[model samples]
Target: MDLDALVARRRLGWERLRVLSRQRHLDGAQADELLDGYQRVATDLSTVRSAAPDPSLVTHLSGLLAGARLRSAGTRTFSWDMVGRFFVEDFPAALYRLRWWWILTALANVVVGLALGVWLYHHPVVENTLLSSVEVQQLVQTDFESYYSEHAASSFATLVWINNAWVAAQCIVFGVLGLPVIYVLWQNISNVAVIGSLMHQHGRADVFWGMLSPHGLLELTAIFVAAGVGLRLFWSWVAPGPRTRLSSLAHEGRTAAGVSLGLVVVLLISGLIEAFVTPSPLPTWARVGIGVLALLLFLVYVFTLGRSAVRRGITGDVDESLEAHVAPTAG
Candidate 1:
């Protein structure tokens, strides 16, 4: 009940715990002693809180306990090992696990874009409504091709990376709402369709594909992956299977976060291709080949490495040690 008396009684033990916690290394016996001291001091703090109610003593004990807890638990640091594990295991495993979602998303968008391009090509009136004769001529002749080369390569790459990354992030973050992801995809695909239709109509289809195919393939795939992952996050709560809705959402959300991070690197690669390769003096075939190669490597990485990782029970989630503790439920 007496604060002063309690402090006097526990001071030696508290000091011992502090010393153990601050030690860079500890023997088994010293570790045990530290644990015992931690328990006793915790009890003392509780008693002082109820009986003595001394704020200063409470604060000191709280700080001491926090240090001890950290020492006991240890700390994780950034390392090459962590980066290797993430790309090899976590990121790809996530992509493989959710492959169907993004694949379907890619397919649907392609279909829509193609169908719209065809319709717009046939309906000259639609293009007239969207762009005047001069505007169309300018876009087909100059704007489409010049846009890529208008800026410095490094700056253009950075700009494209930021813009694409933001779009991908939005797809994941707003995926839970369902409609927003679709809206984002529609806006992207429709613009492409309109431009492609106009280019083909004006007999500049070569210019359009030659410029776009160099970076658009991988860039668009990364976006599809984000949209798919986002839709999956939304579905986690919608159809949670046997798990509670909250639990399912938490699991998928963690995976989605990892996917978002991985997409940053993917978009960066695509951005580089867009800036350097797309507008390079290289032949159109060589440029498109580079883009095709990049997409193929990404796909192979996802299917081969990702599939293997997923088979080993990696769901692209954070380490089990990092996950929140879930209460066990009986079947």
Candidate 2:
């Protein structure tokens, strides 16, 4: 129990831990060694604090123990480098892997919205049931368009971003339930279809298309991506393939979370357009063209850059160190 003896016995282990703590990366064996050393050093610090109470010795051991604890616990530091990697690699690769899911979701929602719009245009009664004569007229002539310009551009952008982000987040967070994803999609599409049908029946299809296209293209796409991720989570539980159901769900869940975060930026761009470009006095073609351009850029990022990332073995999931970390199996 002599403090000098104790220090002599443990000082080498503590020094090794200090060395390992400063490393940028640790091989598995080194990581294990760090953990063991961390525990021993922690005990040494406690013993020295109680038995010796030497300020300098306690301070040195405390600092070394703290660093070792961080190294052993895998502390993450936020950095511009990590941010760059996420956008350049993680986000796009996640989108690429889930491209089919989102693409299918986008296509199906668009088709349903169009079909419903067409059906409602033909069925005046249905449109009337949804909106009375006064409501319909107001919606077509003023309310629909005024809604975009009623607020300051910046405020409107923030408002739209928050609302849309909430929707997207809900789709991902509630995706495990399965039916919620379907219900969310249905609610979104139904609202658009109702509005579109009413506008078309009122002979203001031009207004509807013009106002909607300036932001709807990208906005709707982001929503579809959220829905796709959510549905995939649900399906992961239903069919995990080679992975255990929990493993499949967890992997998809992490990727889904990444997609959710990335879509926030995507939705912000769309919101800005809806607030600024959609309502500005720019020519209809110009406004729609801006929206189209934004959508095209997103598509290219997901498909083009994403494909390359995927081919490079990136799937927007956590790195192998954090994954199951298993060695490859023989087929």
Candidate 3:
């Protein structure tokens, strides 16, 4: 446990490990020597720290071993460029590549909602069963509009944003189940359809569309995108095609995760519109136009920027250097 003796015994091995760690590239012989020296130095450091406990010696060996570890396994650091590329390329590319899936999801949901609305409109008995005549009348006349303005705009926006984001997150996170995503979508569609039907019946159809279209355009689209991604995540394993099931799932799941991140912003915009525009005294056309404009901007970002990003080989994944490698083939 003598400090001097301990330093003398391990200092040479530790120096060798340090030198090897500093090298940018190692020849075959050097690489083998590096590994050998690394192992020896690591053991020496452990023995010295336990027996000698000299702060200076322990510190030097510890630093040497840390450097060797880094050299042996490699390391990475986050950079601003990575953040910039993610927003400009990775996020949009994922959305664009998965465009068809989401488009189909949007269409299906709209159709289901419309069908449900029509059916409910035709069946007064169904409405009566769900809600009393008086309650239905209140919903049609005042409750529907009052709901938007019931709270102050800022707090309402925050609440709506958090609620919508949670729903979208659930869709993506639980998307592997497949059925959950559909169930969520069905629940949403049913709510809208029931309210829509009641409004139409009460001659408040204009009010219904006006209240919804301002925020619903983008809000629903974001939800549809999340649902599509979730569905795709489920489908990746079911029909991975040429790729191994795990590989396909990982790839698609990574892309789907990007949609989740992107949708947070999308849903926020929708929430803002719903709070500020929907209940504002602004003309319905102007408010709806703002929503349409927001949706259009998102679409352009996806189709235009996304297509370009994909062509450039961005897949909303970590850069290739960070990606896992396949083992070399014997052939």
Candidate 4:
């Protein structure tokens, strides 16, 4: 029965199972079973991982590339499309779950910010704190007319073009740890609350629009996305749905990471707008148009790019020569 190989496979499966189980949506029985398997095989998988020949990661990637090539040629071999679909199914669901918790945290921050802003507005210590940071000083003290009128369109385009991708990347990359995600979520929510309070005090809601909507919102969302990626990892460990806690966390570890790629693009777009457009002389209506367009593109890419990977194809393995993704925690 090739017991050694069978055991190796089971060990690897348990590792994957540990990650998927972190979702916190699984039945008690399944969770217990997965947890047991994860513990039993973890040591063995460690050995397999360390002792295995160069770990053959390339082989897995190669197989997928080969499948893509075959599909391009319309060959009648095994259905490899499922591989991509499987990944999209899991990644998006994880992202959705992470966002939910972030929303809840954000709501709490909003209340705190409103309370603080009201207090500060009445007391008049707000601008002083901002002066502590040169960046904040620049943002707060500058006249809206000079800033927005100078080069609004170019600023808007650059900001959205660069920072949106940055947000996505951070959410994907640093999310492995719980703290990074928490920090990101907290920072964004707090800033919004603080800014809202200040604007109310100054009777400058309209003015705030020029500085904020131009690039701040998009840049902020990118940061949140970065945090979301980390939160996904954190949640997998803390909650673990239908599997054991450890098993659910393990599954998340195996996924491909692209948070850095997204981060670079996001910075370019958002940074440029923050530097140039928000302070420019563009009309309110013009700013609105740019923000709207940038947001729509983000939605379209997220919902559409992976549809081919998610919505089409069988839910299982396709052909030989290609190794199937090892199943989660087996007996």
TM-score of each: 0.81, 0.79, 0.78, 0.52
Worst 10 residues of 1 by lDDT: 322-331
* Tens digits of lDDT, candidate 1, 35-116: 8887887787777676766778777887888788778778988999999999999999999999999999999999999999
Model 1 residue 211 CA deviation (Å) reads 0.5
How many angstroms is residue 293 displaced in model 2 relative to the true structure, after the best TM-score fit?
A: 0.4
Relative to the true structure, how large is the alpha-carbon lDDT of every model? 0.92, 0.88, 0.86, 0.52
Error of 1 at 319 (Å): 0.7
Q: Is candidate 3 or candidate 4 better by TM-score?
A: 3
lDDT of 4 by residue, 1-331 (tens): 3435755556466444545444445566666655555444444433444455234532432333343333322435456674454344443433343445444544454566567666766755665566445544455556443554555566555645554564455555566666665665566566665665555555676877656776665565556555545566677778888867766655554432433344455556666766665655678767756766665665454555434334543211223333333323233
- Of 1 and 4, the candidate ahead on lDDT is 1
lDDT computed for candidate 4: 0.52
Q: Residue 6 lDDT in model 1?
A: 72
Q: What clash pairs does model 3 have?
A: none
Positional deviation of 128 in candidate 4, in angstroms?
Answer: 5.5
Q: State which candidate has the highest TM-score.
A: 1
Error of 2 at 132 (Å): 1.8
